[model samples]
Target: MDRKKIVEIISNHYSPLTPECKLDLITNSKLLVLQKGTVLVRGGQFSDKTFFIVNGCARAYYLKDGKDISDWFAFENEFISSINSFFLNIPSPHFIELIEDSVLLEISRGNIEILSNTYHDFERLSKVVAIKTMLKQQERITSMQFHSAEEKYKNLLSIHPDINQRIPLTHIASYINITLETLSRIRKRLTRI
Candidate 1:
């Protein structure tokens, strides 16, 4: 949760930051330690803060009727934010919840605007991060539409093999658009084959 460490991690993702930009981020960002099951962003809430995870994990989900459908997960060294709300200044459609006890560095939207306006490199870095985020979301949507549950599961495992160790089976099943029973069967079959 150290500001220096958080800045260093984020810098690695986009581009090298100027000393002033780093200082501004360090000064504006705040550390939060969230407990498991904590809801950081609720659907329909206006949230302008973005989080950088330093440790542990979180999930973004949408509530349909009474069911919670997980859309994405953020682990250590990942960014988690209500993108629609953060970018458009509207209520969020997703709820972000802490899946494990986590350390996060939070930056407000206003501060991000200031940084982007004052620093050209910061703006470029933000664009790169936004592009990457959009691409990941698009890829997820494509996989969900074109791939079977087992195929999605395998692809997820290939990218994040340790995810099963971090999240519960039920959440993983929901994320991959499969039932818990189906996921269990898939695991059993994979083990046997």
Candidate 2:
């Protein structure tokens, strides 16, 4: 991935980083090409690396009662990490998987800390990322508990307009806290209207 391209993506989320800071970030992070079905972090494992998706998509999910319950998905120019484990230094309750072949910039916790301490811009970016993550979690919890399956599905599309085309129905259903049959019915009903 182009360093400038990645820098531009991050700039969209937080304040623009100085050219020197972007160069430093490029030097500290490693570019990785991951295949679909790749599990970067698994439940009960400790991994503090956060992946910034330069391209493709990934998900964080839990294997609950032998079923994969997707919690969230990240597409191009998004950051996806095992949040609790990465932030709290505990075993992850979820697994991070590449749903599509992905190009990622892997930033380790130590490097992130070093960068944050060294550059004020990185610190600001970290704060913005944390805030966004918290807000997303809050929204998901409230939506799943209060919203109907159709509402939840529609809300998801509002947030990720192209998700239905990119993600599988099973994953979408699970993410919206509905059965696959229900999701199919909702989609069919919406299409007819």
Per-candidate clashes, comma-separated: 0, 0
Worst 10 residues of 1 by lDDT: 124-133
Model 1 clash pairs are none
Question: Per-candidate TM vs. native?
Answer: 0.96, 0.95
lDDT of 1 by residue, 1-193 (tens): 4888789888887678888888888998899987999999999999999898898899999999999899999888778899999989999999999999999998899998999999887888788878877888898999999999899999999978998899999899999899999999999999899
State in Å the error of residue 32, model 1: 1.1
TM-score of 1: 0.96
* lDDT for 10 (candidate 1): 87
Q: Which ranges in model 1 have alpha carbons more than 4 Å from their true place? A: none
Q: In angstroms, how far off is 126's CA in candidate 1?
A: 0.9
Q: Any idea what lDDT model 1 has?
A: 0.90
Give the lowest summed-lDDT range of ten residues in model 2: 11-20
